[model samples]
Target: MFSLATWNVNSVRMRLEHLLRWLKLRAPNVVCLQETKATDQEFPYTEINEAGYYVVHAGGKGRNGVAILSDKEPREVTIGFPDVDDQEAKERIIAATIEGVRVLSIYIPNGGSVGSDYFLYKLEFIYRLREYLDSYFDPDQDLLALCGDFNVAPEKIDVYDPELLAGHICFHERERTAIKLLKEWGLVDTYRALHPDEKGAFTWWDYQFGAFKANRGMRLDHIWVSRKLAQKLKKAIIDREPRGWKKPSDHAPVIAYFEL
Candidate 1:
């Protein structure tokens, strides 16, 4: 069995202790982290290495960042889209081939507001992701998993209150459509695949207004797998315990297990 987990830690440095504790508790075979909010220079490589995983990361200061941690060294690693020149966007994506499976840690931009330039960029990022897959992988053949904070809830069931949240930043129709197009390109939402009708299963909750206590949250984080890789899926879930811990990140970790 191989276990993979994705988390948007908000700020890695701030939550390093929690991360270390969870690492020991879960012991996932691979971990995909997003929103590390630390530049490569500031990343705590030594601490993470001491926890027993080799990490590959690309990041910027106090903003978007992504990383992949695995027990075994990756055969190959890529920091970003080969053709995309935007450094910030580059910092949001990182890929590594571990144990013959290609894994990607992605932090899709959380468009601040609907119809804003940043929102358009968020949609464009999804489009570029499709292009990236077209150029580098085959859904029918590749064993690949795309994991991290997507920042968009793909379905109504993914959000706490579908009607109330309609057109909201993360639940907007445009964002859902964009994510659908990416899924059409050959990715399966692993958690949804395993729990098609599950409701209120969210990975992110706003820190304000007692959102977590009210169970008002959205499933913005995910583990998407290609058809070939999806066939190996055994279990997928949102680990809410960490989010309940003291001073936790607004986002919880999503974990998936597979029979490899």
Candidate 2:
């Protein structure tokens, strides 16, 4: 049995204390972190190394970053989408092979507004992501997991208030379409696969208006498993209690356990 977790730390430097506490409790075999918001020079490599894990990270100045931490050192690590053009190659994706499983950590663009340039970039990013995965498709691989903060709610059930959020960047139709395309490519959403009818389970709570207290949240963080490993999935959960912690990130971790 192996357990994997994904969390958008918001800022690794600022939340190091919180993360350390959580890691001590959960001790997941593999962890994929998003929104690290720190450069390579700024990451606390020594601290992480002391925690008994190998770290593979891709980060920028302050906005987007992704990383993977593994209990067993990965045989290989790759940062960024493989086939992306130069423009989209900025830090957003990281992958590593741990225990024979290919793990990917990604932080999708937030796409602030409907018609904004960032919004277009978000859609284009998904397109490039699909293309990159197409080239790397390997059905023979028995364990492949992609986990991250996709910055998207693929269905109305994913958000607390879908009507009010319709056409919003994260809940927009275009983004949903892209996500659906990825599903068609044979990746199963492990959480939904376990709890097909579950609801009101969310990973991200907006900072404004005391959203977490009111339970007004969205399931933006996710774990996707290739069909081969999806069958062995044991359980999946969103750790909502972390959001209640003092000075917590807007997002919490999503965990998936499997019998690999």
Candidate 3:
């Protein structure tokens, strides 16, 4: 059995203490981190290397970074999509192969607002991701698990108040359509597959207006498995306790267990 977790740390430097504490407790076999908000030069590679894991990171200046950490050193590591055509290489995706399984960490763009340029970029990012996945669709290659802060609430149940957030970027129709297109490409939401009827569970809470205290949150973080590995899924859950810690990130970690 292997346990994998995905978290949007918000800022790796600011949350290092919280991460160390969580790592000491849970000790997941693999961790996919998003929104690191630190450049490659700024990442504390030596510190993480001493934590008994191998790390693969990709990040740009102040936003949108992704990384993968593995208990056993990965055999291969690739940062960003090769098909991105140089124009979209802002460091948002990273993939590594550990014990034969392919783990991908992605930090999808958070569309700033509806019908804005940032929103268009977000959609284009998804399109690029689709192209990347299409290049590796062979089932015989390796089992794949894709995860991170997708910045998307997939369904109404994913948010506390759907109607109140009708046109919001995370819950808007265009974003949902883009996500649907990806799902149609043979990826399964491992968490939702395991808990088909569960509700009121969320992975992100706003830092403003006491959102966490009120339990008003959105399920923005996610774990997705290829159809080949979905059958091996054992469990998936959101660790909300981390969000309650002092100076915690607005996002919490989502864990998934699989029988390898």
Candidate 4:
């Protein structure tokens, strides 16, 4: 069984200690990180390299970065949306193939709210991603995994209060449609696929308002696998342990295992 995890660390530099500790505890074969909030020059490559993994990052100066760290050096690493390099500036995505599995770590833009410009951008981003995935790889043939902070809750059961968060940024209808589009494209939500009837399983909690204590959190982060890889699905989990730690990121790690 090989394990892979996705985490939105908020800021890799600020959360390095937590990350290192988590790595020691879990030691997943591959990890996809979002919101590193650092430039390539500023990314802690030395520490990560010394930690016994090769790292690849698409990092910006102050916000929105994604990276992949793996026990094996990846083949064919790409930054941003494929075939759209000129408009690729936000460092929201980094993809690579490790051990024949094509994986993508992505940080979807927070829509802010309904009808906001950021919301539109978020929708566009998802649409383009669907196109890119379809163009670049065959879900039926290629072993693919798309993981990271999606920033969108796929269903009401994914949130603490469906009625309360109905029209919110993360649970809005338009945002969900975009997520559904991905499902239509053949990516399975590993957690939901494994925990169909489960609830109160969340990956993110607001730092304020004692959200974690009340368990008023939402499942914003995810690990999505293509049909080809989902066949080997062994386990999927939302690791909330780190969330209870000191100075933790608002987000927790989402992990999945596959028998290959």
Candidate 4 clashing pairs, residues 3+ apart or interchain: none
Candidate 4: stretches off by over 4 Å? 86-90
TM-score of candidate 2 versus the correct structure, residues matched by position: 0.96
| Candidate 1 lDDT over residue span 65-149, tens digit each | 9999899997689888887788877789999999889999999999998889999999999999999998989999999999999
| Cα shift from native, residue 78, model 1 (Å) | 0.6
Compared with the true structure, the alpha-carbon lDDT of candidate 4 equals 0.91
lDDT of 2 by residue, 131-179 (tens): 8777887544657898999999988999999999999879999999988
User: lDDT value for candidate 3?
Assistant: 0.86
Q: Which ranges in model 1 have alpha carbons more than 4 Å from their true place? A: none
Q: Which candidate number maximizes lDDT?
A: 1
Worst 10-residue lDDT window, candidate 4 = 81-90
The lDDT per prediction is 0.93, 0.87, 0.86, 0.91
Which 10 successive residues of model 1 have the least lDDT summed? 81-90
TM-score of 1: 0.98
Ranking by lDDT: 1, 4, 2, 3
Greater TM-score among 1 and 3 belongs to 1
